[model samples]
Target chain A: MKIFYELGRYWIFLAGMFTRPENFSIYRKQVMLEMDAIGINSVGIVSLVSIFMGAVITLQTAYNLINPLVPLWAVGLVVRDSIIIEFSPTIIMLVLAGKVGSSIASEIGTMRVTEQIDALEIMGINSTSYLVIPKMLAAIFITPFIVLISMFVGIAGGWVVGELTGVVPSLDYITGLQSEFLPFNVFFAMVKTVVFAFIITTVSSYHGYYTSGGALEVGKSSTRAVVFSSILILIFDYILTQLILI
Target chain B: MIQVQNISKGFYGKLVLKNVTNTFEEGKVNLIIGGSGSGKTVLMKCMVGLYEVDEGAIEYDGRDFSAMTKLERKSIRREIGMLFQGSALFDSMTVEENVMFPLTMLSKMDEEEKRDRANFCLQRVNLDNANNLFPAEISGGMKKRVAIARAIAMKPKYLFCDEPNSGLDPKTSIVIDELIKEITYEFQMTTVINTHDMNSVLMMGDNIIFIYKGEKFWSGSSKDILNSGNEQLENFVFASKVMQDLRRHLKN
Candidate 1:
């Protein structure tokens, strides 16, 4: 019951934020900037992780397909299937929980701890929209872009492993990947990305936005943001997968 | 004008402020003086809607703040400005950005207008040349100046200061007090300051409300404070040796 009340209050706060034109105006510019900070700027870490993920998927698939003359093309098919269906988008956000989610938390949490949030209240500004909405929009709009990049890089990483280990010929590997690919799988991944983005960004911002006390409390808020958002991301990943594919 | 009427707040079933009611009028520094844990700060916060009141209501020009919707309350909040004890400037932002923040967030003014207004406010607070400096690089006094500049950037109708004289030297305290008073007069703002400093009470206390154990024990100006004939008021007014000497000089 208390949780529902909290959610209801959050909705009211958000509603109040959007109802004002001046406050919503701040979001337009701030969101674009935050998208670059939390989303585009995460390219290096996402790419590096995607490379490893692809290599690992190829290795696991090769071991499974190695039984008594199973075709190498089948191994390529499995790698593409797993990468498209699950690995790239979901794991990337889990990694983002550490990088982007924590950054939002600490930044906002410190603002709260230091009374900057109160300062905003006195200035007649919507601190939630000024601080949270920009980051929220950034997370929702930019995650799809990041996930798209991750998928491409991860698939490329698999290709590297398949060729180097001679698990599959390059031409046949590429063909198998293309043949097994379903357009709807990519669409589903994008949908999941949006949902996950909303959950992670909103939860992380919420933790930071309401932070109280001193410096220690800000640190705790950041940690809570990453841990809670990451766990929820995994849980929702399964639920979405079941809903989409089953 | 802000009229706090019989406002009380409790936390975890423990009463913190018991029926605090006072009027902080426009263009005057209204000081809420009390010892630590006496609920001065909490009472001021209750007036601003930062904390909810358990009983009674706060009125801004007779509009009951507690009965208003969150959006309506927020609209009132936008017309209010605050300077926190810690200065509370954003560490990541430059002084210019910190001052410009409220205008950027709240005003429909163009960037140039915002920049011009921010610069003008910084200049008003004698921080014109320090616009590029970060809060960490500035002195405590300068940080307070930055906070004042930020607070006034929006030209709020009400200004609240919590511990405005804290952590500063006697000289800087007076300087900040004078600045607050000057701005209060210039803007015709309803200024409410919470302080424990007897010096501040005498110096900036155009209107003083003394809270003793969460109730208004004394309501008078800085002048009447020394002669209120209330023993507790006398003890508090003469707590400082300097004040005692001054009181003695006044008597002589």
Candidate 2:
């Protein structure tokens, strides 16, 4: 019950924060930082994962679609549908909740444990705006790019698998992707990434913001952040997909 | 210049601070002394808006804090400073960065000017060359000093300290206490401190407010503390055999 109330309060605060012009400067800095940490810095790992995911997803789609009598072109539809509706946004957020969510929880948890949050309140700096807004904005700005990269890589992985396994001809695979992939689907994935970004960033921050006790509590908050926000993201993702894509 | 009136706080239906009313005056070390879990920290937090009061209002020079809008409260908070029990300095920032934080966040000063002000504060706290060190590198005393410097960097009108001597040794505690006293006098800041250390109560408690089981049981000056005559106050002061012997000897 306390957590629910806090969740509501934090969102209201975050929403109200964006109304201030000073928050724009904070948002800009946060976006750049997020790009560096979430997009540029995490690119290698995300890309590597996407590459493998792409190959595996494509292979699986092909295997499921393969019928001796069925045309191979339909495999592209399966891959496209999965990537657009489920794989890219949801999986990327899962990975990020571990990496980025934990960072938010730990960083803010340490701040809470240290009384830095109190220090900020004393200094008249809205600690939430000062600390959370930047991270949230950065996540909102950067996650779409990350998902974009992941989608490309995941799809590319499928292409590679299709080529090597001799299950489908390269031209057919390329043509299948070209024909099956819709522009709206990519756009939808980007939009979903934005929502996922907001959820992970805000939930992780909320977990850390109200932390109490000492180093032990900070550790617990950080772990809880990753575990809980990841679950929240999946739940929200279902609602979003039903509302938006279905 | 801080007034807390009939403030009550409860957690999960358990009352922590009940009908607590006190005033922290300007240019004084107004100490709130109590045993562990006596709600001194909660009272401080209520006065500072960290915890919402269930029944009453905290006023800054008679201005109702609870009635103010969030923005108004934030603006008023700019005039306040705090030294936390944990000396909660930012770990990633260096000492200079930690000191300059209030300035960076609130002041219109440029980076060069902010750096100069931060250095001045560090110097005032006797941390002149330690600006580049991290919080982890500083001694416990140094961290408290740094926390003090950070608190005063803004020249806040009100300063709230929660167990400022909690983790420090006796000698260091005295030093920190003296520093707080000096700063309080120098700036004429209305300072409120929550503490349990008897030495601090004797050495620097110009005005003392004693809480007993979530209520303000006694309020008096340190000078008159020995003769409060309240049974609870007597029990608290003479709890230890050495203190009991000293009280008896002093009475003679």
Q: Model 2, residue B109: what's the lDDT?
A: 85
The parts of candidate 2 lying over 4 Å away from their true place are A1-7, A10-16, A19-27, A73-81, A213-220, B248-252
Off by over 4 Å in 1: A1-23, B234-237, B240-252
Residue range B1-252, candidate 1, lDDT tens digits:
998888889999999899877788988899998878888988988888878899988999889998997678877887888999999998978999999988877778899999999998888887768989999999999999999999998889999999998999999999898899999999999999999888788888999988888888989999888789988778877888888999999889
C-alpha DockQ for predicted model 1: 0.58
Predicted complex 2: CAPRI docking category: medium
Task: Give the number of the best model, judged by lDDT.
Answer: 1
Model 1 chain A: which ten-residue window has the lowest total lDDT? A16-25
Candidate 1 — which pairs collide? A124-B78
- The CAPRI category of model 1 is medium
